[model samples]
Target: MWTINRFPGLWLLPALLPVILMTVYPIGHALWTSLHEVMILFPGEPFVGLRNYGRVVASNYFQDALRNSLVFTLFAAPSVVILGTLIALFLQRRFFGSHVVRSIVLLPWVLPGAISAVLWVWVFHPSFGILNGIMRDLGLIEDSILWLTNPRTALMAVTFAHVWTQIPFAVVLMMAALSTINSETLEAAAIDCRNPLKRFRYIIFPEIKAMIVVLLVYNALIAFTSYDLVYAMTGGGPGTATTLLSFQIWRESFSMYDFGAGSAVAFIVVVISAALIVAITRALPSDLFAGD
Candidate 1:
């Protein structure tokens, strides 16, 4: 007699085995490594007991990298969400060549991050760059700006490039959410809500609110952990202007050959990212996860 109790629970082990090996083991290994003094050039891995963490916290580079990461997330995440929603709204309308336009919009997102960064590097070049040429034609400036080289503009340039790559993803998700909205409800609301802004506030927004929150959290996490763009474009340069924590980890581990410090930084990033995700999820509407 097949009953609920008779069901083979051990059958699920195969599915769970991969997750344990991939996620659980790596995190445990990293945590263990962070507690020891392990250097590539050194002969021994000694028990340091949080010394690496203390050094990482006290370092000026760590402070700069942390601040830069937060600043980049602040700028890049919201820009991706807002621009994505706006573009999604435009594409929602049926018009000639709309399909073509939608395909074109996804080109940036389809390209590899390193490739996108390289393209942006050329675009932001001080001389013979399209951006500068456009600005010059518009009479915006006579002198060429060092976009990636200048400390002030370097972070902004990287953020812009990140935003461009992320927006297409946001648009696709938003459009999916928007498609679920009832057209009759929108039409009914249009009677009293003649203004498009009012219609969105009253009807469209409430429908897509959950997706918006999802996009915010997803994009924020991506921006916080971003590495490829910074590595390819600026190499965290102009003196640490664009160095995020992810880049800091790479530099500490490979560049400086301090595996202990890099592991500590990596663990810090994991903790903070997990906390941020949890906090945002809790603070938003409780019904966000509710099923229709």
Candidate 2:
């Protein structure tokens, strides 16, 4: 009788085949395409080696898009984890209307990204929007803020929208992690540590640290590649102020018909994202995954 370990590769082939066909094949095709000049301006899709990559790298528009993506990730990722964890802690307790509150928390994330963008666009609208009207009623400011139009505020506005949708997912994940904490362990910690902060520091903090790290990395990846929200909300407008790498790739490939250059940019984005995931995985405490 042959053991399962003797035929590990054979057993895994069925599962791995679909992944290779779906992911690896497409990536290989893109890399091959990126090596040529496939735009309308060029006939026959002549081989250009790394010229497409060079063009993409040299373009000022691409640089601006990269900067905007980085800025969005910086603001949105941390906000998602912090706000999510805080809200999760609040909702995890048994209190009056807690179920309703948890349901309400999921509303933003459940809505489609484009829908959320459209909803927020109205909320942030300059004239007669709820946000502006409320601020005015409170005598906060006389003038309405251009939340999505002005270059100064456009990226941050989108970040706010992205974070709103991300928080619910964080809450869901962190809540699950919180549920795994043993009640007896927490009770013992409470007895030894009178202060709430110390109890949380010695007990709750250690248990939830891994979840928080995972949430941060997950949120960062989403923010880095976010496209639909930006498209529906700002259209990467106010003159490329919010044109992230995803939108930039869309513009290059579909709008300008620069398939080769777009593929080069996309491959670069993939490389960066992969590197970030690896870094995040490496940063996890060794003991965090010891059981697995």
Instruction: Point to the candidate with the largest TM-score.
Output: 1
Q: Write the per-residue lDDT of candidate 2 for residues 149-239, one digit (tens) a residue.
A: 9999888888888899889899999999999999889779878889977887778978888888888889889999999999999999989
For candidate 2, the 10 contiguous residues with the lowest summed lDDT are 283-292
| Over 4 Å off, model 1 | 1-12, 282-292
TM-score of each: 0.93, 0.92
Best by lDDT: 1
| Clash totals, every prediction | 0, 0
